[model samples]
Target: MTGTDTDAAALFASARERLVDAPRERLGDLQEGRRFLGIPRAARIVPRGTAWHLGVLLLTDDAVLATGDIVRSRAEVRRGFAAESQRRRAELAAAAARGGVPEGATVHLGWHPIDLSALDAASRPLALREGDALVRWSAAGGWMPLARYLDERVELLRHPPERA
Candidate 1:
């Protein structure tokens, strides 16, 4: 195989080894609720603000694929009949029924592929850019290589810092 092909295969293998699966109950919720083309090769659920963001990675035969950010807001009661709030409530209910989400959390599953052009102004700074590699673990932490990002993220999820 060519050098590039070999490198890609190595990267894919590394990612596969480092990847951690999301909670089993949430897999179907993520697939059907988020409308993913198929089950992600690997996924990680990390807390973001009062929400949880599911970071997904899919290593396909031809390319390394990822979703933009699958966010689910923390559960809370809304007093108004605002359309958005109503929609969120319904989404939360569906996700809860499927055991994909915790109580009261609202799911926002958009089909956005992670790419340079696809990133908006707000998301650009957070994404790491190395030639063709661009990825983000959270809203903070600036930019970093994909492999480093995965390693650090996996470690963080496994051993979160104790809150002061």
Candidate 2:
């Protein structure tokens, strides 16, 4: 979701272009996507098979914020992070209680960060998140060390995706 000023304009243009010649029934949904993405006049949207659900793509100064059926603000993301963090901690505890993985390895969870310090250097994950799978961080830089994952994410949030 990081790019230059032109990327933002092009993305918005692509999104807006979808509006013209669209069916009347779909206009409302398209407008909703625009509103959700906080774009002025454009947003590329794909049907999620529901009136309120849509695949949205909107570009900002730094990155394209894409999501399926959800438009959220920074505060919302922070709350979600706190909740997910607590859930993951509990899950880790439960897993440990039931005999966790041995040294040099760890379980992978969609929202949890696995500790790689105890493992060998070669086995370390440069970064771990819902990305690529949910964030696609690997494409940005697989060379990044595991310790820098959080910092990378925080940086990615340089601009928060907003809702109308």
Best by lDDT: 1
RMSD score of candidate 1 (Å): 10.1
Question: What CA root-mean-square deviation does each model show from the true structure?
Answer: 10.1, 20.5
lDDT score, candidate 2, position 43: 28
lDDT of 1 by residue, 57-149 (tens): 433223344434344544334456668867655554544435435754443333233343333344343242333344554466455555565
Q: Judged by lDDT against the true structure, how good is candidate 1?
A: 0.42
**How well does candidate 2 match the true structure, expressed as C-alpha RMSD?**
20.5
Steric clash pairs (candidate 2): 1-63, 130-134, 131-134, 131-135, 131-136, 132-135, 132-136
Question: Where does candidate 2 stray beyond 4 Å?
Answer: 1-113, 121-124, 127-136, 139-141, 146-149, 161-164
* Model 2 error, position 131 (Å): 26
lDDT of 2 by residue, 81-130 (tens): 36876654444433322332332222222211222222223222322332
Q: For each candidate, what is the lDDT?
A: 0.42, 0.29
TM-scores, one per candidate: 0.42, 0.19
Best by TM-score: 1
User: Cα deviation of 17 in candidate 1 (Å)?
Assistant: 1.7
